[model samples]
Target: MRIAVTGSSGLIGSALVRSLLRDRHEVVRLVRRPSRAEDEVEWDPKRQYVDAAGLAGCDAVVHLAGAGVGDHRWTEAYKKEIRDSRVLGTAAVAEAVASLGTPPRVLLCGSAIGYYGDTGERAIDESAPPGDGFLADVCQEWEAAAAPAVEAGIRTVHARTGLVVSQKGGAWGRLFPVFKLGLGGRLGSGRQYWSFISLADQVAALRHILVTEELTGPVNLTAPEPVTNREVTAVMGKVLHRPTLMTVPPPALRVALGEFAQDALSSQRVIPRKLLDSGFAFEHPTVEDAVRAALRP
Candidate 1:
């Protein structure tokens, strides 16, 4: 299979690219930067243009191009960046795909569990109604932005991901130093439910979607079990052989992350119903086991 992947340099994208390459599939990257050697293709998403001819023969396109959600402060300005990067980039990719004389069969675009917003202790799945808040709105629009491809008779799978965990980078890398120094603990009230997935499971789930013709629309790329903030802290503590003695309250996060603090503090109990029903196996189903596998340094 010849796969066209955007955001091929980021944490998840890079890993997925490697996995696809290992399977002897040709991987072409749709880069915002200049295309390098081989099957690389250049695209200017902000201007909303792509070389239709370049993407003509690809079997699938895994669209992961977007701004880092947790990278910038959630101010009005940064929020626009978040929205534009996803909505615009996704629209651009879909448009490009639509314009293709022979479009790809499958499109695995990135979405998030944030689409369910803060569900408190209530377990939400693909059947649940859309929730509120900034992240939720962004996620809603992000997935909606892929309508063109779906309308064009393509199998579009929205990978509604959760807190993607990896030891090499992402949310875990920032905590490694603190946990290694025995200073880690729960965030906010510590009871907020956290929906997370290890990098291995995330990539595998994506691969599963690429081949599964029956699956489409908001596939939760998360583990079977979702944990609380306290659970995550305990898991990390157990992995590092340290005691989670202190708790960082919500106010502290507010001070540290501004408006974005509420996002981390929000309780989102999301489940992988679609994936499970469709028979996607998770390598790390428990947060503790996933943490141990990731924190193996």
Candidate 2:
């Protein structure tokens, strides 16, 4: 299949690109700068422009370009950056594909489990309605931005991703070194449930969604079983052979992360109902399994 992918340099995107290439699938990388290679296409999400000709004849488009939510302290400006990056970038990709004479068969727009904000211990799935919070609002807008492609009769799927369990990047990337140094511990009361998936499963799920014709709406990319922050701490310590003796208080987290701390400490017990129902299998099904996969060379 010929797939055009944005955010090809990101944690999940990079891995997905590698997997697709390994399978001999042609990949066109959408970059913000000038196209430097035959597989490169220039796009400007800020202006909502994509080189339609570059997208022509592609079988699918995986739009994943967005600002890192945890990359900075949540100042009001940085929050806006997060929202604009996802919403605008998705709109650009959607519009471009819709304008193509023959639109891509599938449009997988990146989303997050944050859409079901602070679900506490209650496990949720794709059937759940949008929750309340900054991220939930942003996710709704982000997914809606892909309407152009959907309205054009294209198969649009919103991949509501979870906390990726990989040392290569994302929140887990920062946790590995801290845990290895024996500074790892639970955050706050450590009771918040964290829905997570291994990097390998994440990429595979994206590809599954791309090929699964019946999947057209929101599909979670999380594991079947979700673990709490305390459980994750234990697994990290056990897998890394480190001591989990420290505890980060909620107050300290608030001071350290600002508004983002609320999200960090939020509990979301999400399940991959759609993925499982669609016959997608997870390479790492448990927190321990994910930690071990992340430790692989």
Best by TM-score: 2
lDDT of 2 by residue, 59-101 (tens): 9999999999999998899988999999999999999999989
Residue-level lDDT tens digits of model 1 in 1-297: 999999999999999999999999999988776778778888987887676677889999999988887787788888998999899989989988988889999988999988988899998889998899998999999999999999999989899999877777766767767887888888977899999999889999999999999998889888889999888888888888987787788888898889888888899888999899988888899988788778665
What clash count goes with each model? 0, 0
- Local distance difference test, each candidate: 0.88, 0.95
Model 1 pairs in collision: none
Model 2 misplaced stretches (Cα beyond 4 Å): none
- Runs off by more than 4 Å, candidate 1: none
Q: Tell me how far the alpha carbon of residue 272 in candidate 2 is from the true structure, in angstroms, after superposition.
A: 0.7
